[model samples]
Target: MRCHIFTRDDWGKTLDVQETECGSPEEALQLGSAGVANQPTEVWCGPRRLGRFEPERSHGRPLPRLHALLTLAERRLHEREQHISKQETLINRLKREGRDLALALCVLDTLIETQKTHLHERDLIVAEVAKRFG
Candidate 1:
């Protein structure tokens, strides 16, 4: 391997290389990398340009889509139901507004689910037994 070392001052003018080697560039770097001076080497920003460095970015937190949508829907429905119920109650006291009140109640009833009752003789017996045991 052979390496040739060349240095320049602020103006990028060619500087002197101490040793000569018949090796590759890697070997040349190793050979010339002796007790190197602790001085900051000057850069030739006039002729050659140095690329800008970019740092790693920190990622932000993610939100759940389904949970967000469900929360939004619940809030909207809750608001709508409150408004309609107020209107229905207002119309209830005044018979002239019965038609509008009924409509509002209908809408509210549709929005609210009815209670479901499902029971069998065997399930009732089991419940009764559990109640007696308690």
Candidate 2:
């Protein structure tokens, strides 16, 4: 099979194109993966795209593992957001009831700090993924 490998820059613009002949789609994928050592690459056979590979970061972790981590980070971030929302609601209710709010407010402050950490973690993972795969 004749395959074309497209090397893309950080902004996703095509920087170079190379054509090679391979025995199978797997071979084309391997070639593309190797190409990703220098830059992001896309493998195509005629009009069909066989695969895409990004420069490996995360200490040489595989692409699927990075994707899995991204998924987990996003889920955790979402859960943290919900917890923060519920905490805010509870604090508001305590205020309306004329209940002592020192402890509740303290807990809310802690939750806000934790939410900030989660946001930072999620943003880091997102930026890493975009940098590697874009």
Candidate 3:
């Protein structure tokens, strides 16, 4: 978003403003600090004025608008984190299922080999009995 830091005249008319392109309101606040002197500096997004900063006041508490913007950013970050966590969990589950399927195939292969060996033994016994009877 594009933000502007403006110094307003006593009549509440804008005297001068510095335009800065920022991703978030926090960045705008940081950029606005440099333009602020003894005059009150206000941050604007597009045509809408968001918040004002006073040099006399400590920066500990943010203005209501800035606070709401920061809160929204935080909520979006948390949602993305949760989505990533769920994706990781699903990937882990898929890996475990793949391993189990591989193991089952291995067991089936072993059983087939065992059945082939038994058939070979039975053939030998039948051949011997046929020769003796003939």
Candidate 4:
């Protein structure tokens, strides 16, 4: 479960959330930074609610893991991250299309399909890690 920072717009009445960057679960899975001093004490989760949230702490007392994701947040975040990664690959391939100019460009589309296969793998790893800490 990754902890996300969200804000609300008064005029539009919309909640804004800063999503984490999508990176490989195999790569360095960095967590979010903890709350800092003098920042807004309250977070906006939705249009109807604005309040302070007690971030769950790790067992290590004062030392918490980077991003503490709620159960649903974890799953959603994972999928979004994977999508971002796949898009990155596709975009990179498209950039080369001008030079390559080949009909087999569809192979680039397969990159995302391969990513779907890895979803369950990442889920297992994340689940195990979460169970260990949570």
Candidate 5:
């Protein structure tokens, strides 16, 4: 059987893709596991996924620190999203009352930028989790 191994970096970016011949799916899985020294890897046969391997440090153990950080990031991202929603609602209400929107719009813009930062932080954490716990 022909197998393809995909090696990914800590950020889930594909660093390399290699093709190898294996006798079976087990051989493909072994090949993938052997090559996963410090990165995450995936083995595939045609359109079927054979197996996935992670670094030894995270082979079967969960990193409490990383999990906590991911939870915090997700919570912060959700809070920011809620804040943006409320800001938009407030802006709409003020507009309906024929009040000045210049300051409100500026605040909304700042909130949006902050939300983007939160989203980026959450994405980074998610990628890290994927790399460690694939």
Candidate 6:
């Protein structure tokens, strides 16, 4: 995250802001204070204040808000991506199974038709034999 340092100018009316990208809030605060020594300054990341540095007293180690937020967002996005991938795999498997089932049904239909034809032929032969013998 980028840290913005704001300080007052010579007239104490106009403000000057400088931005720096640092590893941690502590680092940013240290760099901000060192950049503008003996000046009343505040360090910020977006709208959240990391800490304040005064000429007499400087405070350190407030909180690590930006890092925590970024980590959480990244984890959630990874979980969603994994879920989408698993769902796509399941859908493809189901489609393949459905096609196999349709092919089996067509085979069963052909078998049934062949059995009916054989039964009809047997009944005709029986009728002809009974007409000659009885």
Q: Local error of candidate 5 at 94, Å?
A: 1.0
In candidate 3, what are the lDDT values of residues 17-59, reduced to their tens digit?
A: 7888999988888777767765678899887767786665343
For each candidate in turn, the TM-score is 0.26, 0.53, 0.38, 0.24, 0.52, 0.36
Query: Whole-model Cα lDDT per candidate?
Result: 0.40, 0.82, 0.62, 0.43, 0.84, 0.60
Ranking, lDDT, top scorer first: 5, 2, 3, 6, 4, 1
Q: Per-candidate RMSD vs. true structure?
A: 28.1, 12.5, 31.8, 15.2, 9.9, 33.6
List ranges where model 5 is wrong by over 4 Å. Answer: 1-62
lDDT of 1 by residue, 12-68 (tens): 344453435434444444444441342112222224322211222233112242234
Local accuracy of candidate 5 as per-residue lDDT tens digits, 37-110: 76789999999998889888635335765676577778877888888899999999999999999999999999
Residue 36, candidate 6: Cα error in Å is: 3.8
Tens-digit lDDT track for model 4 on 1-134? 22344433211232455544334321112222233222222333333223443334434222132233234445655776676676666667767775452433455456556556456545654665667778
- Comparing 1 with 4 on lDDT, the higher-scoring candidate is 4
Q: Worst lDDT window (10 residues) for model 3?
A: 57-66
Candidate 1 lDDT at 39 equals 17
Which candidate gets the maximum TM-score versus the true structure?
2
Residue 87 C-alpha lDDT in model 6: 51
lDDT preference between candidates 3 and 5, better one = 5
Q: Give the alpha carbon lDDT tens digit for every residue of 39-78 in model 2.
A: 6899999999998888865575557766776776778778
Weakest ten-residue segment in model 4 by summed lDDT: 24-33
| Candidate 1 segments exceeding 4 Å error | 1-63, 96-134
Each model's backbone clash number = 4, 0, 0, 2, 0, 0
Please give the lDDT score for candidate 1.
Answer: 0.40
- Among these predictions, the greatest lDDT belongs to 5
TM-score of 1: 0.26
Residue 124 in model 5: lDDT: 76
TM-score of 6: 0.36
